[model samples]
Target: MSFNGNESSAISLAVATEMTSDYRTNNPNETKAHFFGKNKLMDILNQNGCVGIRAYYGIDADGNKQLVFVGADADEKDLYSGVILDMSAPCPSNCDNTSPLNG
Candidate 1:
């Protein structure tokens, strides 16, 4: 199996909302979402040999939830030496209240 950077990762709004709602119900104090800037995301995607990306669940020194992103190669291996990204603006601090996914 190989990646050509053509994977379908879409989900219906209803499903997304339900999942987020469940998460909030369980972890009411946790971050509702994480916002990674487009430029940083594009940088990871544009790295040489990067066919996709993988997000790892993380916790910062402050014990806040975060995500660590790294480029993935065609074989689904992490490009550890490439441009890894973090420092997302997490929700509760930066969120769109109007978005259904945030509720």
Candidate 2:
């Protein structure tokens, strides 16, 4: 959980959050009722070589969790995005958008 630095993990998390937002935005009715995980994005994050960045456990959209990340490069500015991950349950590597997985 050592964010707030030029760590790749932090940046990757922020990117994943942004991607999730985009996914939801493009498909509202399909995504609003369910939360999802982007496996490839997560794979990138996991390769960041950092300890597990604790994922807050609870209903994904049950509350507000701010996702603020310091760029891995100092020249890059901070990234702020809102995300709602369904950490409440687990899904396989490829969670399809066709069927809303009730995780």
Candidate 3:
């Protein structure tokens, strides 16, 4: 589902946490080097604290706009090396990306 700036921010945090935990559990081999590879995404995640900073532009299965999840961390290296997650949900008929916070 489409999310406004604020809603997107909230969802980003949730998704980042989920992804981080998943990585720690499922991909223990992951290291700081792997997380901080993407500079831009890592910067945004650091400033926003677990917010899902979109890495690429694309659409979901239902044709709804989707954003890539940027993992959480402070150091650019740490941030990029973290796991990426997906936070797409089906949009309701009345969904409004302009004001997703209302949802």
Which has the greatest lDDT?
Answer: 1
For candidate 3, lDDT tens digit of each residue in 6-58?
A: 43334575666566556557744432111223555444555544534545555
Per-model root-mean-square deviation over C-alphas: 1.1, 13.5, 16.6
Pick out the ten consecutive residues of candidate 1 with the lowest summed lDDT: 1-10
lDDT of 2 by residue, 1-103 (tens): 3345344444565566677667667765442332334663353244333322333333336553222222222333222132223342222333555543222
In terms of TM-score, which candidate is strongest?
1
Q: Give the TM-score of candidate 2.
A: 0.22
Q: If candidate 2 were superposed on the true structure by all CA atoms, what would the RMSD be?
A: 13.5
**Best-first order by TM-score:** 1, 3, 2
Candidate 1, which segments miss by more than 4 Å at Cα? none
TM-score of each: 0.93, 0.22, 0.28
Encode model 1's per-residue lDDT on 1-103: one tens digit a residue. Answer: 8878886688999999999999999999889889998999999999989988899999999999899999999888899998988889989889999998887
Clashes of each: 0, 0, 8
Each prediction's whole-model lDDT (CA)? 0.91, 0.38, 0.45
